[model samples]
Target: MTNLTQARLFRHENLPFLLAALLLALLAGCAGGPAPAPQATPSAEEAQQTEALEKMVRQGRHLDAALAYSRLANRAAPPLREMYSLRAAELLKDGNYIPQSFQLLSEIQGANLGPEFHIRRVLLTADIALARQRPDEALAVLDSITSQLADDERDFRRRYHQLRAQAFEQLGQPLESAREHVLLEPLLDDPAAVQANQFAIVDELQQLTPQVLDGLAADEFGGWLALAAIGKGVDDSLPADELIARWRAQYPQHPASEATIARLLAARPQALRTPRRIALILPLGPRNRYAKAAEAVRNGFFAAYYARPRQAMADAVPGDGGAPHLEDAGSNAPPLQLRIYEEGRGAEAFDAVYQQAVADGADLVVGPLGKDAVSRLASRESLPVPVLALNYGEMNGAPPRNLFQLGLSPEQEAREVAQRAWLDGHRRTAVITPSTPWGDRVAKAFNERWLALGGHVVEVQHYDPKKNDYSLPIRRLLNVDESQARRKSVRRIIGEKIEFIPRRRQDIDAIFMVAFSRQARVIRPQLRFHHAPKVPVYTTSHAFSGTVDPQMDRDMDGVMFADMPWTLAPDALGQRLKGDIARAWPGAARRYTRLHALGVDAYRVIGQLNELRRDRAAHFAGETGELSLDADNRLQRRLLWARFQRGVPQLDTTEN
Candidate 1:
């Protein structure tokens, strides 16, 4: 039926009347007109047929009911033919005997028919032909109803064009189909209608020949027509945007046109150029341990910026000058008080410095060296810039939105040692650590890494650092023939009846020793007592932090450990820092290289502050080789492995 008639039939309040009309139409044919003076009786066959059809229909056996109705309509009279046609239409609505119902309706002569019946017959015939893929037949049926169709039946017109387009597409006439689509486009203002039609059109175009699309003009529909066609095509070489732009230009006033264009444009990637200003806040004061270290960091940053040729440096540094604005954290009590308490008690002294930096238009904030200050800074909130808090250990509280900590931990060192040793073929390993909590922490990290890398820990023994005795734990970890003791017990039970053969000793491939320089010195010789001198030993970074002595370097030789690259002066940055330290303090050994390397790396990566803040995977080359931020934004350093050879700690080139 026409859209209006279909809507009218399905209306909520009119549904009961429609059903009653349908029932009456069905009953009229069986009753054969109004009863003649109330004395007329129906034939048994007629009554049986009516009862069976009604019972089947009520029971939802629409196909069986349709056949009964068709047989009944064949014998019905002229006056009752309308009821036959109506019954057939109802059967068609039930989606049973679709073609046969239409065929039955088509047999009706133009007699005393109302507009509703005429519309119903024509629409139902068209629906059947369409369902059977006979679009030409459906169009012919629709053409017969054109004069009777109402002007308000716009949805029918749209569907007519849509179906015509589908027929044309099936006939391999894509251009005609496209023209019909353009004509129907006006009725697609509703989102649901547009989406449905768009999908239908796209699906049809996929089956059409590519030459149809190729024949279309480049700038057609400002390119939406071409894009839609291209989107339908299988080839990826189509110029998508050009087609879309043409289509959009043609239909600029169309609803959701701009939104579609914006969505399509947004899908393309574009690089954003955002300028960033970083603030370095450091304590530059007399007699402070970090004063020279801070200066060395500043020098390192300047060196990185100016490391290239003059033109490259000029391009990198802002405004042709390479100097960065630095705010000293101050040595005097008043300035420190002003920096901290100007806000509040718990507020950090660096807060004011940060505020000043923000006021000066900084995008990133870097320092405030001391642990207490960094920890206090971490606890506060709502900082204007992203802060890279540079404390040496894990901070006390939650960091701010843009704040990150970039410090090394003993756990991190232990994990690195375990990974390196496992990668270096150390499967059967032993761990000899001190009884302190720090030693336990190292042991835990080592155990985790060793287990993760599919290595077996032969033994884990703890030793007291204060005691001079290290022979017992060292000997137990190094000795591995427990079968001998088992054999001895068996011998005692069996006497001379069984002679037990001794099993060969299994030497531990490696030892992960956790101790200070003094304790390490005592334990080094004990490995020789167990006859496992050539067994490789790995230590944590604490071993390199002023713990190794020159006198005991021979005993500690061949012992490899993970440490910052600055400890061995691996690169130019490390070498420069070492030179500065030697020039500043001639008598001072390179023991302070760890602290120096921390400063250099912290400064060097400041250039990548934005990337570091945004991307957790961003890696940087530092005085400690390669470094990356972990999930918590803690700096995980790519440590260097140094071997103590002869009388000096030599950097291991092969493993890092």
Candidate 2:
């Protein structure tokens, strides 16, 4: 009893102290224990998955990587989820899955993300707008957020500059585009990337003319201006290597790599050999079938020849057993001798005339207009002298040596029409061609080029070009016959007739009609009557006669075709020639305008052939078109586009 009483007193006295010591022990334990194992972070497995997905992106398996990132985003939390979503959208856009990427991008709210991710979202949106060819929208979106980006964010800044540059390029602002590339170059670390950016800068600068270039600050672009000026100043005489050496000495610290300089040097036009004597052979004799056409060509040739002061004719004198030789008068350039030889129709006749021209000391022979004659000259294993044939040869293999062909081939125009329609965003097309050889050639060329561009020819219908009526072909092309037949079947099934309008096939986005104006005028209206008025009609130059007769061409409205600048918007030289011809040869000016242009171009090309031959990129601004020489030595043309509105052809300013 005494021990129990003592223990009770001890317990009562120590109760408060024991309680305090226990509470202090509990607090110390709580503070010292390993901090609550940091709330579940991205697991090792998730990190590994991220690395693998990034690896896919590096390997260029963008779609696969994008889909994987989406899966990860679905399972991840805030910030991380937003980041993965942004990444997925980027890859999809890069891979050209625009609609799907935009849809995914719409699902992610950028406001909730961090500064970096929000910027990424904005860039992706702008990029998609650019892909859809809406540069204005892209530029607006970028301009709004440009101030928010920090200067030190090199990667984001680089992308921002690139998108801005591309937007400017699409909007036809080359100078602005080049400025962005110039800014982007310094931010790029990789050597190849830097080189590419430099080239892009030069390319944009090249689009500017010398007059335009003069207005720009030379020092601002780090020698890009000097480089482009050197490119533009290149002539037929100055050696490109020498120019390059001078450029190097002038700007030793320029950023353009040696590779870029080398490429420019390779593309430079080589020195040309101006012929002292030129012989023109054509069927110009009175009895020749092409005499009238040949005379028109001869007039055009002389017009171009006399236009140059270096070749002023003294007087015509009869040569020894050949055509008359016209000697050049006193001029700065060396005296030139021009001789005209009358050609016969057949290849053998062309051979005789060609032999005579070459024997007559002709340094260059330009002529023999018939296709067969050109083919004959082209078939020869070797020619004694260079000949720029006026017609293209039907060669089964590589083009012959020393023979350059330049002609207003319908095939070239057909290919250009296909290109124009393709660029206009047309994919599916129906072709209606005249049942003729020329029509077949044009249609074949269009089909070959259109298909090569990954376009589809839904249906091709050949119509009788001679007949004025194009109902059958038009109906077949639009599938109106099928629609009408279905209506009839439905009426029979219901034992009654109902009011109906024939419906054309909804799949075709365009129509490629190979017809002359007479045929096209009738066909276009029939197309409208067949319920396909809005479908864009694309054609070759044949659809528009060289003269403007809006009253007659009114029915040919809304038709787009590719034609020569001489017929569309001739420059000062062309206008002068037109005026002169109108006063001198009014009838020929109206009747054979295109043929006259052809002759003028033929004469102009003789001096330019060497430049075109040496450099594939060199162009001659001829009356025919923007002329360039193909690998086959065939002169190809980039024609201007024109659309008929209320019967008159208006030049399309959007050809570029």
Candidate 3:
């Protein structure tokens, strides 16, 4: 139904409750002894104070504003006092002072308060319960207040339904949550907010499986379910736009706006042109610096290619323009024809090979493994064919059109570390990384993300990775050297020996270290010796060797890092691939596990790049990580996190 009709129905249905709420407000006003005060409400002095407190809130001083509100409540009378107290409790809750907010809300009693105050108090109680992770309690409180809401209370009704939806989401009831959002869509006034609610509805409904969608009851949210089911047809032979058109024909009166429909069609994952002739380009010449790494990637690409279903290959179509096709009795060749092009040691050679591959009918190109090679390709505005570069290139802003980058990026891992540390309640941190270009990039990524999250980098020290002893950098990073200098100054002034222990800086709650396992083994022990044994350490995947060796890795205890599932906890497909690689090429399987996984993902991503690029929620479960594409056409990997405990990297179940 249309939003206007829905809103009118809502108001009509709650007519009795509205009249009762009005009576209660009138009675409360009479009992409190002044209708003049209700008209005047906040006096001039209270207005000034409230304006000042609002200024503090605007400046992010939530605690200060809350305290000011509490003090104002103490000096105010009757309903004003309770209103001020409710505002204070809301500010406290927004500032993450959950227990204080809860206690303040509990103390508030709505005896002779107006309808607004009564609704605020009830909503505040439910909000605090939600903040405390007590979704069941929050839902119960909301249920008790649901029927008491009046027709005129549009804002309160919005908040009430929003809280109910959140509580349902917390309880793993996405269908129920979606229904609540569908109900709330008509109440939203802002265009952006309405679009967000629409997307949220689709996201919740998308969580349900096809079986659930098929068996869904034709109730109030049937149009919503139907829309979500159409969106989920990414792999369907029928185009997604056509499916959406069919849905629009069926549910024209549904609440989903025109903008939302446009967005759905834009991001719809229709069947992209499948490249029958695929070109794999890499710096694989013997003299190339990245020859061995390229070899590992090549092996991985072929492994994934060969793993495709035999029947699918047997039923292959011809290439572009109905070119002739070839098949052997037992060759087990991929349906898509594959060719490897050797990207020689120079950029000039790479260009020549890339052109040759295109001339040879290469519809899709996946390679140019070197950064410089990828950068050369990225400089172009467009390419004759799509190129999935193995390494990210330097781009001033967004990536070039038709070019995608996917690699084991340390910068991505560093950013993940920043987010993980913030989630773990760390606000201040120190970083110790290698004094090299790669370390600088990783450190810059961490600092940018950390600062964006309102975290502070107390100190950032660079260490020489070649040096086995990291005492100097560690001491500098912890400010232990400064502490020792102070102790020496005290001893010299007293003209006698002084018993003192050098104290490390107390401001930092976490340490972000960028190092390989060898460097980390030394760094972790030195950090303990320097009196930082309890401080948490976070790092990139470089800190783990990807192979388990308890005796060697015992020194890595308590260090948390993010790595691909293939290295940490391989799934059945990954295990099978790992075994196949090990038997075929043991060295690449053992020594270059991560690169091998990257290669496998590169092949898998080739087919899904269109979907990943258009749809933000689309993902491919590959050997590398849960692969998705960012706006820049760069493939982003959400790696699994693990903590080293007694030399074994345990998958953090908290994340699961």
Candidate 4:
């Protein structure tokens, strides 16, 4: 059958009343009465009044137009009273003047009107009450209409039940909402309402018991899964395995069956055989500046691996302190460090590392710390064991399947800042960035995320880092249009009538400045002088990377920025790693805590690759806070926001 025919058949079985109403309306319109004779001329006064009302309605001045129409209609013949009442009803749909509209309708004795008119009045009053948030009043209006409503009003009744359910839900009466759901049960089978009912059932399950969900039919499993996934504070204590088994047995062919099975299977532990050896590569030479840093990171990684309980590694590593074979990427030799296992760049490095690991019977490969080394190793086509890139790397066109990059980046910080601003309800923002490549990178990421959230970028102003004056760019960004008189007064007060007016602070709601310490110090005070201190300010990670002097702190009060969470908490793992690093080199903990934490997490995940890949969310909450692998295989971290308070970066809140 054709789609329209199939739709008609479905509706006949699902919403018969709706179909009947449409048919009735169509038939009534088709059977027309004799046309009235054309009038000689239209009333000039009436036409003028209608034109004015039309203008008011077009301008969204509903109240003014309603009053104007009522006055004109009242002064005309008795037949015009219906026209005035209709116009008044249209205006009253705004809900602001519901009570007033009801009073007007009552004064006109609407109960004595025709059946259609009475029905319209009742619906209008109920809608007004609902808009005014008076659920009880709306219910009373609908109740009064039910006794007198004709048989043709079944479709209206269905709508009334739906509206009643919403009102009861809003009023926190779940029982009443459930009762309305029962009333809508027939409509639930309608394809148009199926998805909507699914959503509603999921919402209801938040307050319902497992017994209630179990009692539902097999067809309702999809709705239950959707509910379980999205419902707030849903109790997950019920065993997922058991639930999946029951669902599979009851509805083997359900649409969501495969996905549900996958989720259940992932929750189970996978059997993995222990391998003989593991390969560890690090840059270990005298000439490299990061040679000390690299050693510290390697120590952190070992500390994390050994920190796991003895039973956890019984299968993976043989003894209590099973040592992995270490390789050195050499001294003052870029190619040696960049090339993994004496191989050239690209897949050769990956192949060499994999072959060496396999030759030693290793289960995993860790590191090749530098970005170049990582890029070269990751360019390989295949590997015998999973390689965890210890340091950050450019993923190039695509990231390696078996390799994972774990490190902090500027793009991550910018995205976090923009997301935080959006969640805080700042819909309009301006970006002030340095005219540098790094500055552009931060600005681009921030702009992309902000725009993705349906926010508007009012201005993107770039300032030359080498230049001193930023007032013009700031003013242009703020779109400051100073009043002529105020400008003249300010100019006279300063004893110089300058042509350029400085930007005012109140113009933009939020400002994102992408600059380091020195530029931040200059721009922040300028923002305050322009009366923009009240506006919330965001900056990149670079803001906290530099020295914060007394003057800088004074200027940057209340400014917030995103950085790795280790900066604040530096968890148990982080502290242990820091202590290990400190034992090797004093005062190193304070400077390299972030990189140390990164190294520890990278090591832990490499050992538990199966679990990490199986449950991505569980891999999150490490020393560096939440971390997830996006579609691109790049690790996305949940950064924390810190405010500059008393010359220190303090944890603001757990908002982002």
Candidate 5:
């Protein structure tokens, strides 16, 4: 109301109390206290701009909203200005404008912003690098931040670690990636997700060698390696309380106690089955040709059978001991009622020996370690008990019940080579193998699997493995000589000579070859000599000598082969066993590494074969390979792939 109106009300005679109160309020106002300020209101242009930005965001026009935020960023107040840039970056990133987001984030001054904004900018920058497929760049950006974060900042810390892991994985630094995963498990909320991420860490570390892990397990790096080991190797066979207690003692401060050990105890999967009565049928006779081979196997079986989680942890490397590496747990199951039987002079005596072993109360018979003896056993109608024969054999009729075969089969490797080549997009293949029954077997296996996978066999050529000159076979395989023949014929007929380069067969995208070291040294280079160097060559494990012979193997470079886990072990235990075997019988390992793997698996499978057979899809991760049960009672090994690089067989990253 106006002052004149108030004055008029005060002058009124009626309603004297109201008029007196109004006069007193007017006098009080004139006596003046602090003046009341007006409420701030949006100006027309500012209001319109704010509404437009909100409208763009609400309507899903992210680019327009991002542009508006960018335009308004300078006009925004201090912290709000950073928020505007960050929001714009987020919008740009979602729209796959990585470079734009990166540029915007790069321009942000973290020193002038809150710690949260600084973290966001760094994370956004790393994410942008990742989006551009520049993991190393992303890692470099992330590395500028330290591991130490404030209590309120753990979310950003976790994001930093997650992005670090992604960058490491993209850079093919799996062990580092796995370490980050170990750290990340605690940050994860879902129990299942935690377990899955823990398993992923285990799976990744399980692919590294002890030699490699040992190099890294210095300082803080050791904690994650130790955690992953426990996840992979600890099972029901271990005393849950004791195992975790021991781990806690060594790594009392590690987060794995909560992330891994506690969860494992709760899961309570059944312990690895330990057979009550076991018989080891070996070729241990003094004069037997396979005696040393059997010895390698025996050592391997004993090494695994006697191993302990603590002992493996205590040793420089797991499974590096000769035998009895750990004090007997005593609860792992009574030392298997052990019996040893030797195969006699003839195949005719095999059945008798097996029967006698069964009569002696053997329940799980491990082997007749030789192929002939296995073939003899396969001839029987049925076995008295479950028998896991060491070598797969040729049998006439259907495989007998309660009999399972586990062999280090070259044929399996050959088939895997074909499958791998096909998987790598090899449409047609040329075959050049030895002119022998063994070569025929392997070639047939490769061809069958390749054709089944819709790959074509362009041609086949045989070579003399003993011969040094492989030019003829290589030329035939590549059809280079045929091209030369056609060129010469054309030149003679027309009486004209023009520059011409002979072209190898274009239909074949890969070569399936079978060669031992002796042949490989010549065949590989000879194929290259025949102008087929660029055509990928896939071969059985025979192409690689079990032991590295750099000078001799140099020629085999660029050839891809399928080998067993025995030869290309992906785990520390396997690597350590290999080291132990080499130390004990260096000479035998030059040829018997595969047999050692067989021995290890033979003992392992006795406990797991039933599980595998029950579930056809199940695989036992064994030293030999991933062992799976086939319908024919054979435990087939799915081999590892490698390419000869710089005279070394490097495991293919694509291999499982």
Candidate 6:
């Protein structure tokens, strides 16, 4: 009846005792009249139906049992009929017959069932409503039954709060959703699970004002808030040190208070599941769409494998110049036997290649770099080996545990830019991007993330890639054209000129630009010319080419962006690698230089994948970015922040 009693009754050691108690309850309800007088026998039809009901229940035919129970309810006394209807409703609910379950419960709505059954019926009814995407109806039902649940009936009490939480989420009421989790905390038994749930709630509350979180931390959800303060992946609105101090002052007795702070400085989890043999699948044809990219990646992977840590090769300058390069490995780190296979012949051939890779003793498969190849692999029943798919596959249900999707997606970069902007105190922003599919995708991703974070997109301007002068879009983005129109109209009305300064909209504090190095050079100065100087401009890695011509790029002196460490890490490790790339591939294209960095990370990641998967604090600072695995199991890279100063991209060491 009570939470403790229910827990004790259902515990493994008490399961037999529980079954005996259930037997007595069932017997007390069904055992016939007083023993002094002989009881009257039921009709033969009733006897046959009762036997059939027992048989259906025993055979695990729940739907059939529900049907038989419904028939029996028709002939039973009022109290018996209520019991029969409740039994049928439970069976239908368990069997996922939502319509039937709700119908049966509705039939018994007037049967005068007590608080326990009433609460269960209400919960089920609301659950069915939510399953049908009717959150408003669910909320109404949940509201009507509020007084029925008590601490004694913790089963339904727990479930009631869960339904309310989900309903509020569907209804887009975040505080209410968090309130349910707060209500749920005391009902849970395991501390880890409770902390995990609270962290999840914190994730949903990322955009909430600090005042709201502080109030909650001091009140009903103190422990939950404290745990959330230490939770992984949270976007902290307050400084971490200040937030932890506030939480401690609010709740001094909470464990993990100081210990949680220590984890932030600890190293990432070690690789516990590294594969000995790896399969490298690339489209090797000269004409393949990603052939060159794949080659660069492959070369980069091997260079990383051999570029032993602490070796001078990591810092050596390329013979050609100080360009990005992958130095050859000489040190004796036992190499992962890489088995290469040809792909890109056709999409249908991917499965065969994958199967062959497994047969060739590959414990880990790196990729089928083509998008179509990854899609085909995803559609399969399962992957035989742990796969680090080069490109993202179509998401259909939970992907195989072995499947990991990694890509240099423009969309990923855009989303990160939005998050960084929000963390940096930018609320009203404008977007300046090129007029192409890639540009459209990045802009859309930024807008989506920004809007979801409660920020506004003031304007989005698309410009032609070939255009050198972006004055028109600049004028529109800054509201200068409108300012000019107003000035002209005022001049005409007064028949004389008055002192006028073009006013850009005051709402925007940040501008997100998605452009290549050339376009960035042209647009950065144009943005300053249109009275938007001093407003922070954000861009992707596109803002900086691997090579820098300070004279040519001085116009982009203040733009910040996320870029790989291969080009911008500034330390000796980066310089050495850059020298390697320049000497190894003397004529390497500037843009493709990062691919070599990608290859380096790809090889480095195999050893660290287990670390990322298991430890929330763990991340791999590869050539691509700061890499971590997300809830969706996708490998996400949060790029290093850099600002161009005098044609060189320096790390933005300022706090976000």
Q: Which candidate has the top score in TM-score?
A: 3
Which ranges in model 1 have alpha carbons more than 4 Å from their true place?
A: 1-363, 368-382, 392-401, 467-469, 479-507, 545-551, 585-589, 610-618
The candidates, ranked best first by TM-score, are 3, 2, 6, 5, 4, 1
- Candidate 5 residue-wise lDDT, 1-656, digit = tens: 01011111122222121112112222243245554342134347756886887786666555456656665554554455556667777776654444445556655544766566777777887886776567988888787876546656668877887788879888888888887987786677778667656655766676778788788655444665565455545455776566666767776666664745666545423222456667777777788887777777776775555452322222111111122232342434235555567765567777787787788777778887778788877888877677888888889988677789988788887766775675465678999889999999999998997776557899999998878898888888888989999999999999999688888878888888888878888888888887888988888888777877777788888888777766765467778767766666667766877788887788767767656765554567787777778777799876666788888887664310
Evaluate all candidate structures by whole-model CA lDDT and list the values in order.
0.57, 0.74, 0.75, 0.58, 0.68, 0.68
Best by lDDT: 3
Model 1, span 413-532: residue lDDT tens: 888788667546567888999999989988998898788656788889999899988877775675434655777778788775576553324756888999877787678777765667
Worst 10 residues of 2 by lDDT: 1-10
lDDT over C-alpha atoms for residue 199 of model 3: 61
| lDDT at position 228, candidate 2 | 62
Q: Which ten residues in a row have the lowest lDDT in candidate 5?
A: 1-10
What are the models' TM-scores?
0.46, 0.60, 0.63, 0.50, 0.55, 0.56
- Stretches of model 6 off by over 4 angstroms after superposition: 1-273, 309-333, 497-500, 570-574
lDDT of 3 by residue, 1-656 (tens): 00001111123222211112112222343355443433227889899999998998877666557756876766566577678778987887666445556556665656667666777877888887775567998898888888888777789999998889889988999998998998787788876566567667877887877778777645436677677667656447777767777877887777676687775555443324688888888877677778889888887776766666555553223221121122232355567777787888766778888898899888988888888888888888778888899988887665566888999888988987887786565779999999999999999999998887668999999999998999999999999999999998998899999889989999999999999989998999899999999999999999998899888988888988888878977777788778777877776677898998988888888888875765554567677777777767888877777889999998764410
Which is the winner by lDDT between candidate 3 and candidate 4? 3
Better structure of 1 and 4 per TM-score: 4
**Candidate 6 overall Cα lDDT vs. reference?**
0.68
- Would you give me the overall lDDT of model 3? 0.75
- Residue 232 CA error for candidate 1 (Å)? 37
Residue 41, candidate 6: Cα error in Å is 60
- RMSD to native for every prediction? 28.2, 21.9, 12.2, 17.7, 25.1, 23.2
Candidate 4 regions exceeding 4 Å error are 1-276, 283-296, 306-354, 370-381, 391-401, 463-501, 505-507, 546-552, 654-656
Answer with 2 or 5, whichever has the higher lDDT: 2
For model 3, the superposed segments whose C-alpha errors exceed 4 Å read 1-271, 312-333, 346-348
